[model samples]
Target chain A: MKHQRKPCSLEHARFLRARKKNLAIVWALRIGLLVLLLGIWELVTAVGWSDPFLTSSPSRIAKTIAGLYSDGSLFYHIGVTLAETLIGFAIAVAAGCLIALALWWSETLRKVLEPYIVVLNALPKIALGPLIIIWFGTGSKAIVFMTVLVGIIVAILHMLNAFIATDKNKILLLRSMGASKLQILLKLVIPSSLASFISMLKIAVGMAWIGSIMGEYIVSRAGLGYLIVYGGQVFKLDLVMSATCILCVLAAGMYFLVVLLEKVLVKNPDS
Target chain B: MKKEMLRFSSVTYIYHTVRGETEATRGLSFTVEEGEFVAVIGPSGCGKSTLLSLAAGLLKPSEGEVTRSGSCGYMLQRDELFPWRTIEKNLYLPLEVSKQNSPELRRRAKDLAVKYGLGEFLQSYPPQLSGGMRQRAALIRTLATDPDLLLLDEPFSALDYQTRLNVTADVAEIIRSEGKTALLITHDISEAISLADRVLVLSGRPARVSYTHELDFGDLKNPLKRRESAGFSGWFEILWKELNQ
Candidate 1:
């Protein structure tokens, strides 16, 4: 409060207005770039510079989406992928934090499991496609399993780093107060590691989407990912392009949700 | 007759690091009597912090015994208030840690916040408060646990000169008003003189008590007032010479 110079209300108002104006300009520019790219793409194919069949234009993708909507498959595919991703994101974050806590609590367990966790993280997850299908069968379960597998290791690593990086001084203060390990973890470690946890969730969102789509690419009867594979097989390039576009929007939407969660959870989020 | 609250008898501490061993303190002995405010002054890196750490049970002495009559509350150089918690919640940390989070204790903590002029800021985060207020809140947090003694480790050194003067006075007043014995480890000669009933000067590395002075500024209450008292600079200069030696 002493450092606060206490700007005049009029000056503060002007500052806020200028910031809002800059934010509006930024959003406009982002949308404008997306529109400009779409326009160029459409123009290239509309003028016959590129083959429309080979390189589907934005209008074609839009038309393909409309066709899927009318047939009621658009929502169905979106719902399938969205459900898998959200479920996987939740499970991975929870399990990851819990496993990290366990690893933190037991130094020996962390030592034994750390190298294996690193190996699993390094392994190409898509290579597990056949084993996953055989174990969970060609269903949403296999896709969900794939999603969890892709994200859990990264979650554990990031969260473990956060838990271990809690301030030594604060830990000492708590210990001096006769705090038990469980109390220390609950009061000090978990609350302070919130930023790391939120960032981990943000990363896991992308991994969940990738895992679900990879699973669908290997074996799936539905989901936008399945549509992409089916469209490729049938040479419906517009369908593939449309499904890919939807995936982009879905991933962005999930990322936006995590950002909002960060805003809600951390009062002073490192923006 | 004053009762003895804490005693560190022939305590020696040796820090073990990758570079080998460095002796911090050796044959260090002192006693804090009930209701007494004692300050220890030494040169920088002369194991002032190590001594407090040993007393707080964060580090054990390599030799000899450290004895205490009751629970002790430790205040660090930095006001380590949890950034995520509001002021009121941060004050509850020790109570929560000790499994003493009763409704009465929470109310008393809130009352202490209000009594200490932090009523309006009880719901604010630590970052939102001034440095002085944060330190006050930290002291209140240490007080909330109702420990038999308080160990303050250069608690006001991080503040600006003006804030440091004001905060030390305020903290000294609070500790005195609460009737708690305190062991303050500081490098400031005047600050050590103003707040403490007795000042102990320790020599550099392999720290042990080199000199002791019993302050007798009768009827001087606050730290600010103590500086205004007669013979304040006399005690300051004497301790200054002792510390520099």
Candidate 2:
């Protein structure tokens, strides 16, 4: 048995080596593509093939970011946006889960409110921008509300579907064991929907960022969105580009954070 | 003189949908006595599941009386083990839900797993185990809370033929050794004849007990042994004819 197992282990090792090599090649290609794109953009602007003033190159964006760093405003703008996004995301997930539970608890309530939820999810959220500013008066409060608004509806829908789609047999088993409704919810429904919850978080991260940026675009004194608006108005395209780059990095970082959370919480990949 | 564990007397169940109300079972009457392994066989889509649900007390009868003496454990067609939980944790689920959580019950549940050849895979999740092992885990889970009656709804139908035979033997051994009353609903004639002390056959839709038979195997409790017995084919033929008619 030991002699037979040796060849099988050797085959498994070879398979693992091939997989690692393939992953390395994919990563190298991804990085190479990004570098090539940036290099070409720089070359085009420097050779005067494209106007640098209109479309800021990588170097100009970097220089603008460096200047923002020296003035200590880069971190400030990032912090404001990040705070709004995190708080809004946390609130949206918590409140959405609670509301979904409430809906699951009472079928009558869900029936009455489901149509309105569908309508709200359908109606473009940006259409409420002007009213939002009037109500909250152009502050961080308004931005946070916007972020929550964008994310909460999707969260509710995703979680509610997951809760309802729980296996009927498992519920029947629980009922046979004399489990109450609350017991069923706690022991079965909530735990079973965890995969959906993680997926919802992944989606809500993107929505949260969009909401904060959209809110900032409508009204903000300091944020990446504000920087872009101010730079565009004053014709400083490099500052706008720099702010956009920072937003991309921030969004990616937030998305990875959620991915990390999914890894920690969801032990069963099949589930 | 045997104690009645479950009694369903002229039980009727109606399911209401947007289209209309459909009667799943009508005037279904049966009684399972203590330490009896009774198998109820029916045609496919003959409200077998509705019968199990009614026995488990998950659905109340629309017309007749349904009485269960004590708490019952239900095992479904699919193993229905929570994929997210390890086999051990899945076994503890019933105990947790029924508020029977204690060291003694947990230990007994673990002992059952070890006794049933699942000791090595107790820490493994449902997906990691084979189909037969998962079903065994599911049975152990059902027995965890020590319910008085076991309501089995075609628990072996999901398995392939080979695994189904082995699992049938294992389940019969466990239920018999544990001395629990079990009411298993299945469409498999051989399974009904092999594992059950008494067999009840149901008619097509709007199910009712059309026939009942007490096997003369006397002390023959092992499922595989019963299958190899001379009387097994005769019993199977009778049941098949009854079901077809």
- Residue B27's lDDT within candidate 2 is 92
Best by lDDT: 1
**Residue range with the least summed lDDT across 10 consecutive positions in model 2 chain B:** B52-61
In the range A149-219, model 1's lDDT, one tens digit per residue, is 99999999999999999999899899999998998998999998989989998899989998889989998
Question: What tier of docking accuracy does candidate 2 attain?
Answer: medium
- The fraction of reference interface contacts (C-alpha pairs within 8 A across chains A and B) present in each candidate is 0.77, 0.81
Candidate 1 residue pairs in clash (backbone atoms < 3 Å):
none
TM-score of every candidate relative to the true structure = 0.92, 0.96
C-alpha lDDT of all candidate models, in order: 0.92, 0.91
Q: For candidate 2, lDDT tens digit of each residue in B1-245?
A: 99999999999899999999988889999899999999999999989998888887778889999998988889888898888888899999999987889999999999999999999998888898889999999999999988899999899999999999999999888998898999998888999999998999999889899999999899998889988999999998899999999
Clashes of each: 0, 0
Write candidate 1's Cα lDDT for B1-245 as tens digits: 78999899999999999999999999999999999999999999999999999998888899988988999999988999999888989999888889899999989988988998999998888998889999999999999988999999999999999999999989988899989999999999999988999999999999999998889986686888889888899998898888888
